[model samples]
Target chain A: MSSSDLLLGLSQKALQLLQEDADKIEKLIEVQMENLTTRQCPLYEEVLDTQMYGLSREIDFAIRAELIQESAGKQIMVKLERNLAQLYEALSQSKE
Target chain B: MSSSDLLLGLSQKALQLLQEDADKIEKLIEVQMENLTTRQCPLYEEVLDTQMYGLSREIDFAIRAELIQESAGKQIMVKLERNLAQLYEALSQSKE
Candidate 1:
């Protein structure tokens, strides 16, 4: 394979891995949203925050290593943050 | 550059980035250690733990992306963990 092909393959793989990690956080948010009216694990917020931090670090590292573009990483984070905000909003509404 | 050279350069860059992050955490530990006799932030341990988690996630992503070897990543974590343990020991000793 050519050098460009190799880099392309690596970049694609890095993006896929990052998306997978983000999906896990997405799942966590969905779970919390579903349980908003039922049982709420007090530590769910903390767990989600930690997971978000970890994913952000991975994205930052990938961008620095030239495996993924910074904009691509930011897009993934932006999408996740929107979902997280919805979840938090739902949680608050349930409390009221 | 050849494909192999490209991969080698990327791998080296990934390792260097990871090492730089590990070094930051090491510096955090050193600062805390130096302040052992002075004011304790009370949140230093929590901050350290969060930073460790972030670094571990980055290392994991690098290994999965094939930018670095699993053993290489583990070595970085192990070395930093040792220093973290030492700092914790000192903190505990000072408390006593």
Candidate 2:
């Protein structure tokens, strides 16, 4: 394979892995949203926060390593952050 | 550049980036160790733990993206963990 092809393959793989991690976090958010009416687990927020931090670190590293574009990483993070924000908003409303 | 050369360059860059992160954590550990006799910051341990977690996530992503070997990632983590353990041990002893 050519050098470009090699780079492309690596970049694609990196993005896919990051997306998978983001999906996991998204799932966490969805589960919390679904359980909004039920008694929420106190530790779920902490768990989600930690997972988000971990995923952000991964995205940053991938960008530094040139495995993925910075914008691509930001896009993944932005989507998650939005979901996280909604989850928090819902949680607060539930508390009120 | 040839594909092999490209892969080699990417792999080396990934290793270097990971090492840089690990070094920062090592510095954190060293600083905490040095300050063990002084009044310790209550948040230092939590900060160190968070940093370690972030670095581990980066290393895991690099390995998954085929930028670095699994053993290479593990080696970086193990070295930092050992130093972190030493710092915690000193902290505990000082508290006793």
Candidate 3:
């Protein structure tokens, strides 16, 4: 289907997931909207880059492990959580 | 500062984390934006309600159990991983 056909009215949560699963062009739009509205365009762009270039490649390498199941993706979650802690610290520090 | 003053640019992850925090009013906007961007808005809205009503109360009860540090929030994370597994199952079910 065309991009226009993919357009759908999604709630905030739905929109965010679409952005995360931006495997198709239409999803790209949803993801961009998420970035634009959140004003985290930079972060979104970086995540996209990481997913496409770095993260996916890393996943491929991880496959060589004994058993890399779906949960393996969660390995990156710690880094993401750490980034959140850093972001909170940064925001708090800037405020103070 | 006023809610208007609290307006800030957040990355997708940052925006998401802010949504999770949603303590301040300005944060309310960031959180809603996150809910809107994601397709599982029903999920987000439910989470907000759970946090405000059921979840927070549960946490208060949980605090009595000793511990209840920052890491305590991760308790809900198990539910998330389960849901991811369930979600994939549901999607696959629907597709098939």
Which sections of candidate 3 miss by over 4 Å?
A1-71, B1-45, B48-96
Q: Model 1 chain A, poorest ten-residue lDDT window?
A: A29-38
lDDT of predicted model 3: 0.37
Residue B30 accuracy (lDDT) in model 1? 94
Q: What shift in Å separates residue A63 of candidate 2 from its native position after superposition?
A: 0.6
Per-model DockQ against the true two-chain complex:
0.98, 0.97, 0.02
TM-score of chain B of each: 0.98, 0.98, 0.29
Model 3 TM-score on a 0 to 1 scale: 0.20
Tens digits of per-residue lDDT for model 1, B1-96? 999999999999999999999999999999999999898899999999999999999999999999999999999999999999999999999999
> Per-residue lDDT tens digits of candidate 3, residues B1-96?
332222221112222432343343234324555444344345644444334433332233223222133345445444443443454455446446
The collision pairs in model 1 are none
Residues A22-82 of candidate 2 have per-residue lDDT tens digits of: 9999999999999998879999999999999999999999999988889999999999999
Residue B41, candidate 2: Cα error in Å is: 0.9
Per-residue C-alpha lDDT of model 2 across residues B71-96, encoded as one tens digit per residue: 99999999999999999899999999
Fnat of model 2, as a fraction: 1.00
lDDT of each: 0.95, 0.95, 0.37
For model 2 the local lDDT of residue A83 reads 91
